[model samples]
Target: MPTTQHSPQGHGHAHSLAQGHALDRSEAKDSTENGGEAGNMPNLSTLSLDELKQLDRDPEFFDDFIEEMSVVQHLNEELDSMMNQVENISRENESKGSHLVELKRRLSDDYTALKTLGEKCDQLNKKYLKKSEEYAPQHMRELLQIAASNADADCDRHVEHFLNGKIDVQTFLNTYQSSKKISAERKAKEERLGTQLSALERAGI
Candidate 1:
């Protein structure tokens, strides 16, 4: 009889008929005694003596049985390997999915904060622009008041010269009227700027 020995490369086609078993009893016994292999395989202890005798009478039948058992064992090993791979893939997917969800949540929060900050910036810009616009006309009016005072002083000097007979009445009238005309033009420009400023303020600019 051939010795009952397991090999990593599996059995050859030519197996000893005297050592052939109906079920993988030797392998099962090794498992029970030594915890040699994993999973459930066929055990010859489950077969009747009469069945064993019948299998012993036919070497072909025993050989076929051994072949079938080898095939089943190989298939079980492959199935276990596939199951392990599937489990690993599932764990990796779960971890990645959790990380992706966290990233999406952070991105959403960042977008919301950015939008709020942008709105605040827009509000500040508008406030600064409106104040600048309002101040511009006020500054122009102050400069115009200074210019008008200077012009009035100049006209008063010309009138004094005319009264002292240092200049004629025609020259005096011309100089004074010219100054008044310049003052009128300045007032009209100031009124126009004031109207524009009021319109801008009303429009919330």
Candidate 2:
């Protein structure tokens, strides 16, 4: 459809003029000095859409009129949150370090105590072993000597009976030689064993 352009003549758009108080907005904006310049509808036709949007960002124009308290409060809250997080991290790090140090100290003390205890136990065992070594051979020798004395007493009775002449001389001589020879042989064997045993002891075997 073609636009029927209104004219500035007596009767171009009587309907546009006919809208009553709405058109009287110009009259309302009129002050005593300047004509209705302030009341005029903004002629957005002069600016591109992007340029009009940039107008709100102009600090010189908006800073004097806009309320900025909310922006300041938001920034303050963010800074406070960041500071709290940093403080928490520092505290955690300090606690962890202290705990690790304490654990290390405890471990060191435990190790030291265990080492000393082990040394004492080893020394005690060595002392007992030395006592056992010193006592064992002497005890064995005394036991053997006691057994030898008992055997010697039993032989003395038989030798005395033969020496009293109640038995024949030939018989007594034969029995006595045989018995004394056997005893001598046994004593010599025992002496050989004792020498070997002493050698082994001296060699720490």
Candidate 3:
């Protein structure tokens, strides 16, 4: 007869182990079908601090544990390097954003200034045109009329031949003829001056 062992606790433990294995297999199959990314396993990250403490205190496992210490140190250094790179990139992007805002502000200011300058120039031009229309030809006409009158006065005074003594009929008749010629020339000058004033007034400038 073969001896058989029977214990309720051992049977329960074997059943629990079998169930755990089955659940692990099913989860792995689902993960593979979904092409899931590498994620921390719950069993790994959930290790109790007490469990790690106990392991560290064990003398027989010390050498083996410390053998992997350098690898952990190197991994920490790599993590630090990646974090620095990320921070640097973030700072550069922030600076670029600030620069872009400043440029936009300056451009807006320049556009506003240009618009104001254009409006001012238009107003000044209108003022200049209005003043020019009121003043130019009036001065020119006054100058021309004054010059013609002065010429007439000079001619009338000079025709007498300085006669402070008695004069003959030949001298008086010659002086009268010369005065008549000068009067006609003065009349022509007066007419031409009027014509020039009319032309300047009509032209509006």
Candidate 4:
């Protein structure tokens, strides 16, 4: 029996041919799956050693392959440029989202502060209005009028006491004169305040 020996170069050549055949079969299957239309062809860089070797023997195929490789290279560069733009847009959108969130937080804080301030203002206004009412000119006039009326009533009671022989003449006169002065003064003050309040109302103060 005789044994056959294979050279390294022959083995490599056979392997390359096998790879080319497999690639062709794959392209044929892809085309069939795509309704028998030729799909995207593989890049020249992915060509088998056997296919590359054909460049030396076929000048027309070589030129066409070179042109196709150039188109593929241009398309790859454009795709890379587009991908970079997409990445930049994504980063910008993320930054904008963060900024918008911060703005919303600040707005909420401002609204809370404004609400607190408004509540405080309302409290102060109510307090001021209560104080104003207590010390109002019309209220003071009413108090004075009440005091004047009480003085007149006391004088009338003292007169009755004198007439009933419950008080001396001098004591009754002294009390009567003092009560009259007080009543007159209070009446005068009440009239003055009333006049001032009327003027204020007329002027829309």
Q: Which candidate number maximizes TM-score? A: 4
Assess each prediction's global lDDT (C-alpha) against the native.
0.78, 0.68, 0.70, 0.89
Q: Write the per-residue lDDT of candidate 3 for residues 1-205, one digit (tens) a residue.
A: 9999979999999999999999999998998875533232223245478756766797655555544455555677899999999999999999999999999999999999999999999999999988786455555445445655665554454444435435565775666666556656655766776687788779984
After superposition on all C-alphas, the RMSD of every candidate to the true structure, in Å, is 18.8, 17.0, 11.2, 17.1
lDDT of 1: 0.78
- For residues 1-205, write the lDDT of model 2, one tens digit per residue: 8988756774746666777666586666564334344333344466676656765677764443233335545667899999999999999999999999999999999999999999999999999998887567555555455555555554565578778876777776676676556566555655666787789989999
What TM-score goes with each of the models?
Answer: 0.40, 0.38, 0.37, 0.43
lDDT of 4 by residue, 1-205 (tens): 9999999999999999999999999998886797522224535567788888998789998877865754566787899999999999999999999999999999999999999999999999999999898788888899899999999998999899999999999999999999999999999999999999989999999
Score candidate 4 by TM-score against the native: 0.43
Name the regions of candidate 3 deviating beyond 4 angstroms.
Answer: 1-53, 56-68, 136-194, 197-205
How many clashes show up in model 3?
0
Q: Candidate 1 lDDT, tens digit per residue, 100-195? A: 999999999999999999999999999999888757877777666667777777778888899899989899899988887777777677777778
Model 4 clashes, total count = 0
Ranking by lDDT: 4, 1, 3, 2
Candidate 1: which pairs clash? Answer: none
- Model 3 Cα shift for residue 174 (angstroms): 43
Q: What is candidate 2's TM-score against the reference?
A: 0.38
Question: Candidate 1 vs candidate 2: which has greater TM-score?
Answer: 1
